[model samples]
Target: MSQAMRSEVAESWHRSAAAGVDVGAESSPITLPEDDLVEYRAAHALAPVYPLLDDALGEAARACDALLALSDHQGQLLWVTGTTQTLRRAEAIGFVEGASWDERLAGTNAPGTSLVLDRPTMVVGAEHYRESVRPWNCAAAPIHDPITGRILGVLDVTGGPDVASPQTMAMVRTAARLAESELTRLGGPIPVPHMIDGEVFVRADVTVQCLGRREAVLTVRGKAQVLSRRHSEILALLATSPRGLAGDELALLLYEGDVPATSTLRAEMNRLRGLLGEEVIGSRPYRLLVPVAGDWNLVRALLAAGDVVAAMRHYAGPVLPHSDAPGVVALRENLHGELRATIVASDQADLMAAWTRASWGADDYEVWTAQRDLLPATSPLQPLVRSQLARLDLEFA
Candidate 1:
């Protein structure tokens, strides 16, 4: 290795050793059990990108005697694909699914170091912190969610020292981009609003639906997990508070009148930790450690951008209709009022007509009246709009 390259590896090795990674260890740590591994992969939203990644790097693996691997942001190997001989070689080195390859577990290596550095990295033979893995070389790049700009995982090509070439690094980087592009195509465009100083914003892994009965469908990397009602409220509160909330503050936000016992809250959070992984929620001032895409936030951003139509599409319903928690109630009314006002204030007859027909707006007398007035006498919608207005008038009377 070049002197500069040796210095880089040495620095990483020092850090790994400090983190209690055993340099002389024979194998990486197995932090995930078989069942948990299945759940982890299933919950990861990036699973959809595997096929694209394989397609992009499969031929290279076949020709170069290399293995194409994908690991979650935590450095756990999610999938490994390559020739039978290469697979056998990787298995001998304990490079298999469910293995924790993070630098703290596996010592200095391409995938783990790339994650820590948040950049592309190459580790050649003898550069690996563990002597057991010193025979193999790997190049890896981090893949990020295009919508939220969150690191989803790493894409790597592993083989002999020949795989450490500039060309191999470029291939891994390109494959990472290809996977990200596929993710972007699937998620559609989510406009991130510009933030001024003192303003707080949070991104979500999935859209939180608080309308009616509170529920959240958490999608990370493409894997979806429908959160329980309590989990939905907990996530919603934390996702909105960028600086996080203390135990007392969170309890007040989650409960009404008498706050729940601290033990109850702790137990709930513990269960949530298991489902979301330990890295998602933090202690002390509890907060979401990752970006989340809440439907409420999307609506607010869309409305701010003057895209009322798009905002309406994202408005599933009121935010947590059953929750009487002060914060949640305030958020619910604010969003509901803003959206209704935007629709009523809009001059577009088509938009008013569209809103009046939706489940949320079906009973909106103002929108129905506006639609009635805007439609021509010969228009079929005029009759329906007028009838809706008359019915609303009778109910109010």
Candidate 2:
């Protein structure tokens, strides 16, 4: 209510939160892996008409400093093309071939929400459900089978704020209708676009470095500044809450002793607003006005891409190691555990050694064992590893 969010968008946000989508998720999941993607795409109902769709939207998207994307009825991105600069930037959010734009998984987005509502739609900055995607704006319209009228896919134009205009949505809708007419002219049972089967983010304005520090170091507009512990905690809570939090909920997470008055939480928020500026925060259910990210985002992104070495390089200790706030504790442990699991699975001696040398990893029994198994008898790390293993055995005993 601090800002005017469209009713359709507001409803989508509530549905997204209800579905348990992660607000910090970096990108759409790649539902169409390489295995059958080529074959499936070649035979898809929308496949034959894609060239026409591209021609209709490609020039306009490029002119607008944006990319033209096509997604299946279930919201899997099948094609994404545009100028090299725009494509490169779009890659930061995995806005490429084979990624799913499903609302339940990727949250409220142009491609996903258009399919959900089965109509032309646009999503602008800060209206997005996930933080990493809040910087960009997009407009999309559903492509349908002319005979049956069931949705076949989505046609979208994604770029900066300029893409959110009514004109852009109208263009996309027109392009989609052209594709549908082409499909009608071609004429046949498309069949698989909707009925066939199942299953399954990047740059932000505000960056908060919550890892390896008690209080967060927030960087905005190219200046790095540290926030008070209270402010940092508030930021952390708001950053993670998918739908934002109510006043009473925030109070419960913040206080440890006897519950304080709601006025106390409001007073703290007032001070926080003064420090961070009013534009960065929202009310009703307290939320962030801009897309937010933490340092840990880099490490997880690397890990997910199968780059264990790069992931290890960016793993900068635990998140807010000293904070006892329930939400912070959960995120801290979950991130640490996820990273540790990925490291152990990699089974690379150098990677394990790198982790074992870190203070937090020194006491890790699983990693030490994995490292020991990978090392040779003459390895220089042998003696140190042996001593640590012995110390760990006795320490545990």
Candidate 3:
């Protein structure tokens, strides 16, 4: 779209917000660069969280707190923090649930606008495109997954016109950091074992586990306990990564601390297969029994919780030999790239939150370091990371 046309559209959007009309249907008269904006608005109108998020939003609303609401990468509004009254208004204005904060939809505001600018921002009064919202001011920052570099969503604070102060924005930023800290905790992938019922915990059956506080392993028909040490290791590794390992790669990983000969490796795999049975084992490359995806694991559960850091803990070790295999190695690297990309795209607060957790040697320190190396020194996460490393050094010494 042309600059003049874009400006016109932006102005129209603001007008629509002022008029308290449905912007999604009329936002077309105003035009801009992002086609996805309309789509986002329609999608965002849906509620992302129900009664659970209502509690936080309710608290903020009740307290008449200055607050912000956030969404996930898919643009699902996942969290709301700050004043109870403002949160209620935000929810009433359709900030709850599957809302899209991407710039194309909500013009210059905390959630949608910040995602577009890819930076922190404050949208006050006329700056907002919607008419009914013209009286409010909002500030926002974007959050990202440390490894994936994918924008998780915008962290925003919204309130009455007067409440939109620098102090309020600072408070919103702090809340955003807490949310991002939860994201940091989800950075790693971990094994989640399922509890088996009356069934046998034997070698032939594939086992899936529950990762909750009461942990247990289960199978299709019954409980199983026939897995050998190496088999158990393989299960645990795949459980963590959710990506299967090849025979040679698994061999290398199995021999990491104790180097086993290739033949021994083959024997161990054969024994593992014998226990798993041919039915559970799939085709070539990933010839192991029980496909990795079959396991729900802790990481998957954590991801569902909106905590990216917890999901990351399941990575176990570097695939197999942590080498460059198509299965384990490739997935590991993919996750690493995801982390870097997501972190790169995140707002300063989000990046620092991630750095704070990772730099402290939370998951695999070496892996965390490798990911950190990808960022430039000027990156917002740099200072926090350096501080954390310094603290770690002091603590270890």
Candidate 4:
């Protein structure tokens, strides 16, 4: 019997292949050291939910000869339990605790794909991108932090074809919800900042979101202020440069070759200060008094730490998308270019797929080319890839 993948699963396979995953090759799974794994178990926020998750899924797992696995948001498997034979088989494939099963690492599978899709998913037979994993089927769903709605981890049930049905998917989804409910019940109230007065949050379209809109919101001491174009530009510059910029330097950076009048700049700064309170901005050279967190910084930090997946997740668009300010423009271009270059150089199909899906990379020729090159010649995506390449060729020509 010929096995066909569903559209979603097919797309996941395309993404997995593009990530440079070897379908026939068996790469050793990377696992945390025993000591580190122990610490991770202790510190993981989902630790408490384990008992409840086990209780909820244990009977079903035993009955179906399936394994119940839990992974962190990063797709690092933290726990794995099942019947004796199931455990033995799973361990051979590195489905043990502390192993990373991120799609980037493990290709298209239940837990990894669930993290990427942030929903319940079933990967059946060849739908598992790796040939070795195709013998088993699995259903998985992401668990979210109840308060922030951020993905905390994934819950998965893996076995033979029996576990690939919609019923199994529902079971996993219910288990995930139960885990989240347990987490919330035990977590007490969501922790709120003791003082919102001095703390400030700046949300730049590029920094706060992945859509890369050209707007910003500045919040201080629980009050929110929508920044004007000029104000956002100024605040963005100050936030990135902690050392401060002198009046002349600020004018040049803000206006490029045509510097704004010193008086105009001063008035704008005054208005901005009035809007955000006096303590938020320092006058020695224009700079932010309180630390500001932005998506751009988060991306850079993640990139520096070599977590390209997380970095790409945070990157929505170019910095200060509409800013023609000389310094802002330069900074924006540098960051954008660096991120693209890194993705291309990494040649991870999953990362490329992720980038191509973003607003910035939607039409990026280089990334698309990379994705096409990584795919198998007989892949279902070949025709689509060729069409995209042809269009790009004509457009560039």
lDDT winner between candidates 1 and 4: 1
lDDT of each: 0.76, 0.78, 0.46, 0.75
lDDT of 1 by residue, 1-397 (tens): 4455566676577446534566678887776777877766765667777887888897787688988889876788988888898888888767988788987678899998888667899999888988889989999999976655445788989998679799999989998988888877877323222331111234555445555555666777667778887888888888789899999899988888888799988998999989988888898988888776676886787788776754664466788877777778788899999988897787655556546655677888888777666556766456667788889889997
Mind giving the per-residue lDDT tens digits that candidate 3 earns over 1-397? 1234345335334322322334433221222224544344334311232233345343553355565466644334555555555556666555654455444355444565555445566777766666556667777666543332334456565677545678656655665555545544544111112221111111223444322212223343333454433454555555554356666666655454556676786666567566666665543454544533323333344444544433433323222232332333444454554544443343323332333343322533443454356545555445645665666567776
Ranking by lDDT: 2, 1, 4, 3
- Predicted candidate 4 versus true structure: per-residue lDDT over 1-397, tens digit per residue: 1555577777677677666667775643766767877776666768788888899997788788999999877888888899999988887777888888887678889899888777898888777777778788999999876543456789999999779788888888998988877766776213223231111123221222212647666644324556777888888788778899898878888886767679999998999888777887888698877756665776776677676776676566788688778887887888898889999998676777778766778789888898788767876666777787788799888
Best by lDDT, which number?
A: 2
User: In candidate 3, which residue ranges exceed 4 Å CA deviation?
Assistant: 1-62, 65-67, 80-88, 185-397
Which parts of model 4 are misplaced by more than 4 Å?
1-10, 20-30, 33-36, 43-68, 81-94, 117-211, 217-229, 256-276, 347-350, 357-359, 366-386
* Clashes in predicted model 3: 82
Clashing pairs in 4: 18-349, 19-349, 19-350, 196-221, 207-295, 210-316
Alpha-carbon RMSD, candidate 4: 6.9
Per-residue lDDT, model 1, residue 282, is 93
Which ten contiguous residues of candidate 2 have the minimum total lDDT?
Answer: 193-202
Could you tell me every candidate's TM-score relative to the true structure? 0.50, 0.49, 0.34, 0.68
Q: Which stretches of candidate 2 lie over 4 Å from their true place?
A: 1-201
Give the poorly placed runs of model 1, Cα more than 4 Å off.
1-213
